[model samples]
Target: MALVFVALRVLLGGFFALTGAAKLWPLSAPESEQMKALFVQFAEVFPLKLFGYQPDPMNYQTTVGWLELLAGLLMALGPPILQEISNLFLTLLMMGAIFTLACLKECLSTCIPAIICLGLLRLLDICQSLVQTKKVGRYCRKKSVLKKPWEQRVSSCQL
Candidate 1:
């Protein structure tokens, strides 16, 4: 069970980190001509254009890039509480990505990453609940009632 979570964390975290890092390049090194060209090309695309990519696309893309990068890092290295927060952010990001891909009339293939992230989020949630349930069951069993003196006397009288 732990192995499952570890694999999901690596897969999802690595994917988000790489994609987010790519989006962040323009923000980090604006002086680079290659980065500028990449930004321009992305801004001209369907989903980015919806964000008014031409005038100031870097700011928008950079904002999203930061979100993805931080969320991915949190999922991979932070505590369980942080993981939950990261999951929420990643889920929202993926939903928006899916919506953008759909609007562009792109092939369904492009939406695979978003779908996989969402599925991983659901799986983590289910695993967490199952673990909690097992813990609660053990706790309940450990608290079984102890026999009282009065109950013992009543049983003796009955006999």
Candidate 2:
């Protein structure tokens, strides 16, 4: 189980880290415009439509890159608590991205990968929780068993 978890973490974490890092690079005007167009496509279905905020494509990409990089780092660290938090955040981001793209009727090939990553992250979180719950149950059972003899001895003495 631990090995499985580790492998999942490495694969998911490395992918996000690489993708995020790539977005941090400066692009030419044409590239920037292309990216902005993509962002506009994504924002078309976003729930924040009421805000009337049109995000700059380059800025949005950079911000998303940073988020992915941070989430990837946290997952790689293998801290259950942090992983859960990062997983939830990433899941929501991916869902929103998918929804926006779908709404715009834009077939972005990259969204598939994002969805896959989200699934993997969520799986890892569930696995981590199961492992934690198992450990806690085992500890509690051991403690209860160990206390039974002491309680019996005290009761007999009182009698």
Candidate 3:
């Protein structure tokens, strides 16, 4: 189970990190030019507005890039509390992406990746909660006066 979470962390973290790096472009990456062109086209098409103001296209993209890179790294390597926070941040980002694509009437395929990422985030959260709470198959077996010998289970399992 631990190995599974480790694999998920690597896969999701690497995905967001690489995608973010692609957007920011280190100037040496082969696809930097293409990514820039793509972002320009995206801004032209999407026209995202914040506080009723549209931001500069490159700046907006850069902000998102840095966010993804930092949050993804934290999600992968941070302490448990930070991991949970990063996961929530990334989940919100993915939700925004899906909403943008949907509002633009983009093809269904464009939204699929965001949907998959959302699913993975949910899976990680659920798995982490179950592990932390020790609730799967965990039960309170304290003896009860009125309960049958075979049916004394309760909800206070903490051992």
Candidate 4:
């Protein structure tokens, strides 16, 4: 179980880090521009337009890229609580990406990797929870076994 968690964390962390870095590349301007346009469209779907705070499209993409990189680093550190939080964050990020793509009538090809990464994070979280529960159950059972004979002896003497 620990090994599985470790593998998941490493794989997800590396994947996201690489993806975020790729987005930051100047040579990827075209791809980044496309992402920015998608984000603009997504923002329009909300009330962001009314606020007169139209996020600069390129800035938005860069910010999201940096966020992904940070989240990936957090996940790689293997803090259970932090991992869970980061997983949720990444999931929401992916949801936003999916929504943006859908709004643009784009195919799933580009976003599929992010979707898969989010799914993997969710799966890892579930497995980690299950493993922790099992460990706690085992600890309790061991504690009960160690106390039972002494408890019985004490009761017998009272009788």
* lDDT (0 to 1) per candidate: 0.73, 0.75, 0.78, 0.75
User: How big is the positional error of residue 94 in model 4, measured in Å on the Cα after superposition?
Assistant: 1.1
- Give candidate 2 regions above 4 Å deviation: 26-33, 51-54, 107-111, 143-159
Q: Considering summed lDDT, which 10 consecutive residues are worst modelled in model 4?
A: 42-51
Select the stronger candidate by lDDT from 3 and 4: 3
Give Cα distance to truth, residue 26, candidate 4, Å.
3.1
- Candidate 1 stretches with Cα past 4 Å from truth are 26-56, 146-159
Give the lDDT of residue 34 in candidate 4.
77
* Candidate 3: segments with Cα more than 4 A from true spot: 26-30, 40-51, 135-159
Q: What lDDT is reached at residue 33 by model 2?
A: 70
- Identify the candidate with maximal TM-score: 2
* TM-score, per-candidate, Cα-based: 0.69, 0.77, 0.73, 0.72
**Residue 43 in candidate 2 has what lDDT?**
52
The local lDDT score (0 to 100) that residue 139 gets in candidate 1 is: 82
10 residues in a row with least lDDT, candidate 1: 39-48
Q: Give the per-residue lDDT digits (tens) of candidate 4, residues 1-159.
A: 579779878889778877777666645778767766666776665335566766766677678778788788788875778877877888888877776666667677977875787688788778878888998988787544355888989988999
Better of 1 and 2 by lDDT: 2
Model 3 TM-score on a 0 to 1 scale: 0.73
Q: Local error of candidate 1 at 100, Å?
A: 1.4
